[model samples]
Each structure stands twice: as C-alpha cells, then as structure tokens.
Target: MFVDTSKEVRDPNVSAIAALDEPTRRRLYDHVVRRPSPVSRDEAAAALGLARQTAAFHLDRLADESLLDVVFERRSGRSGPGAGRPAKLYRRSTKQVAVNLPDRRYELAGRLLAQAVEESDATGAPVREVLHRKAQELGTHLGEQNKTEVFDLLERYGFEPRCEGDAIVLANCPFHALAREHTETVCGMNLHLLRGVLNGLDEAGLEARLAPSPGRCCVRLQPAA
Candidate 1:
C-alpha cells in the first residue's frame, strides 16, 4: 500500500477502492483502464453490458473520487462552426493511491534507504550518514510542501499531536515497528527529521527533541526554551 499523508488524500482513495468493490463498477473500471483512450459513457455501458444510466452513475462516482479523469472532446469527425457538443469521456487517472492501517510509511523509508545506498556507492561515503542526511532532506522537503498550520501538518503525517501544557505531544509513532527494533538509529533519524521540518518551515515556537515516553512517539516538539 502507498502512504497517503492526509485524510483528504486517504478518504478519497478509500472511496475509490470501495466504489470498485461493486461487481459491475469493477468490470466497467477494468474495461475503461484497458482501453488506450478515454471512453465515453455509451462505450463503457455497451462494453460492460450495463445500461447507459447505470454506467454514467458509476463513472461519475469514479470521477468524483478521482479514480477516473473526465474529459470533453468532439469524438465524431466534425469541423468548423457546425461542430457538435463535445462528448464527455472517462480515463484512468494518473493518481496512485495506497492506504495502510496504523499509517506505515515503508515506501518512504525504502526510497530514502535506496537513495542512500546509491549515493554512498557512488561517492564512497558511509551509508548510515548518507541515509540520515537523505531522510532529513526528505523531511525538510515535506515540511516545505506544507501549506497549512503546523498542527495540521503534524496530523497529516499521522503524528497524532495533542497539546500537553505548553508543548505538543505526539500520541502515535508513524514508524512504530522500525523504532521498536532499532531504537537508537530510528529515533535519532526521526528527531533529525522533525528538526529539519521545523527548520524548513522556519517555525521558531517549537523544537523537536528526544523525550521517549510509553505508548507515544519517542520525539516531541516542545516550546523552544
């Protein structure tokens, strides 16, 4: 499964997957994806042996969830001022979706590890050092992409932040399993990552620090002292 960073992304992905759960809709979707070009409602309906209205409803639902892209074009060979109304067409969206329980981000970790290995081999640097640096860079990049408040950003990444007195405490560790097995390495990397986030966002109110607690994240972003 792919890591979706926010409810906005994950909810629609869930809806799209759910929509495909219906047998007819699944068949129609399968057919549409197999085609090289965008398909019209009529084509989808006929191909799937479904009524036009049924096909339209399911197609529109898929489009709503962004599983399908909607396009309009004059399918018929026409020209000039007398060209007819454009036909509405459906095509598989380029968007990729992955939803995971407990919010695992193995793919992100894998990418960082892979890049670290490649760079270390090329430049003869230590793999662990390169990996940590790359992970920090990725965290900074993620923070730079945040268009919302820090709270929203934390929530989006599944940090499960909650206010505790003057500081914010994270209730969940997004990298639970990795941290459990490799405590020092993972926790240090996580700390640097969040520190990079704060740096990238120019957030001066809080500082990411290591303050391991049970049933919660090992790192906390506390009010700067």
Candidate 2:
C-alpha cells in the first residue's frame, strides 16, 4: 500500500523506498548494508570516494527515513576525558518495508488463513468457519482503531469506495488476485470482515453484503432497512 509520506497520514514505508531512488543515496545504503558492522561517516565517504560533507548529508537522510539506524560509540578503546566523543555510525534498520501496487495485502490474508488453520486444528472446528471469524475479528479491530469516516477508512485500506444510490461500491478489491482465484472462500471472508467493521464502528445505517460485480470488490455496503 502507498501512504503519501508527505502527508504523514500513515506508515512512511513508501517514503523510505523513494529515498533509495537517488543514485548516491542508494549506493551509500548498499555499502552500509553490506558491511559486517555499523559504518562511520569517514569510512563510508572514503569507500565511495565521496566528500565527507556529502556522505554525512546522505547518511543522515537515510537515518531520517528510517532506512538506516544510527548508533554512537567510541572507536578508540579509551574512556574518560581522553576518550573523546562517540562516533556516529550507520547500519541497516531493523524495520521492514513492503510496498505493493493496487494495494494487495497478501500478508494480512496469510495471517488470517494461518490463524484459522491453527485454531481449527487445535479446537477441531471447521477451517472455513474459523477463517470468517478471524477475518471479522480483524475487521472489527481495524474499525475500532481507525476513528475516521467509513469512506476514508475504506480508502486507507485500498478498497476504493464509491457512492451509488444509497449504497457504497468498492471499485478496487485489496485482495483482487486471491479473491479471483479462490472466489467463495475469499469473498465470504471479505463479507464478514466488512460486516464486523461496520459493527465495530457502530454504523447501524450501513450493512455489508455480497454483491459481486466485475472490476469491483465482492462486498457492498448498503443502507440498512
């Protein structure tokens, strides 16, 4: 999913990826990641034949984007007054960043599926039933966590919600590929998920239902009668 980092609305993973698009910055990142230990400004500069000022600027930028982590330590084994100030070092960040076009959340799906399988195996329950329950639980949690309007929440998750009459149609399905391949299973999960979302949001006005259409999500939100 792409979160416009400039707006600071969500995770900055996309911005972190964009930072590496610069030639020099990408090279500096590559160099730092390959090292056995954190690299200092001087070491990185000398290795890349870049000026110290230029190397410092890019390294700090990488750290700022959270692509790299910053650490300070004394290179010399001295302590007290003579030891001098700690040297700033750069290393690859522990944070993980993944971006998908059209906003596929396969990892989220995988987690739900895995939880369902594990729970079913332990409880001797049906896997499909467990999957739907898990999906709904997650959706409820998402709705409760995000206090925004329904349309904004859907857009944040890449549902691409659109208005049609008194109902909301999703123009893009976040689980497009998976739902296409496993129609019944995925669509059912999606329906329950949105239902739980509405429930958590205390949205008594809208009810989520299955109304599959081409080029749209399987679930549609319609006004409750």
Winner by lDDT: 2
Provide C-alpha RMSD values for all models, in order: 4.8, 2.7
For model 1, the local distance difference test gives: 0.83
Encode model 2's per-residue lDDT on 1-225: one tens digit a residue: 324323757448888999999999999999999999999999999999999999999999999999999999999978899899999999999998888878887888889999999999999999999999999999888888876678877888889889999999999988888999999999998998898889778889999999999899999999998
TM per candidate? 0.73, 0.91
lDDT of 2 at 209: 92
Model 2 lDDT on a 0 to 1 scale: 0.91
Per-residue lDDT tens digits for candidate 1, residues 1-225, read 223345445466677788889888888889989999999999999888889999999999888888889999997779668798999999999998777776766676668779989999999999889887987887778777764567777777778889899888889888899889988877877887888788777788999999999999999999899
* Predicted structure with the largest TM-score when compared to the true one: 2
Q: Model 1, which residues run further than 4 Å from truth? A: 1-10, 21-23, 31-40, 69-92
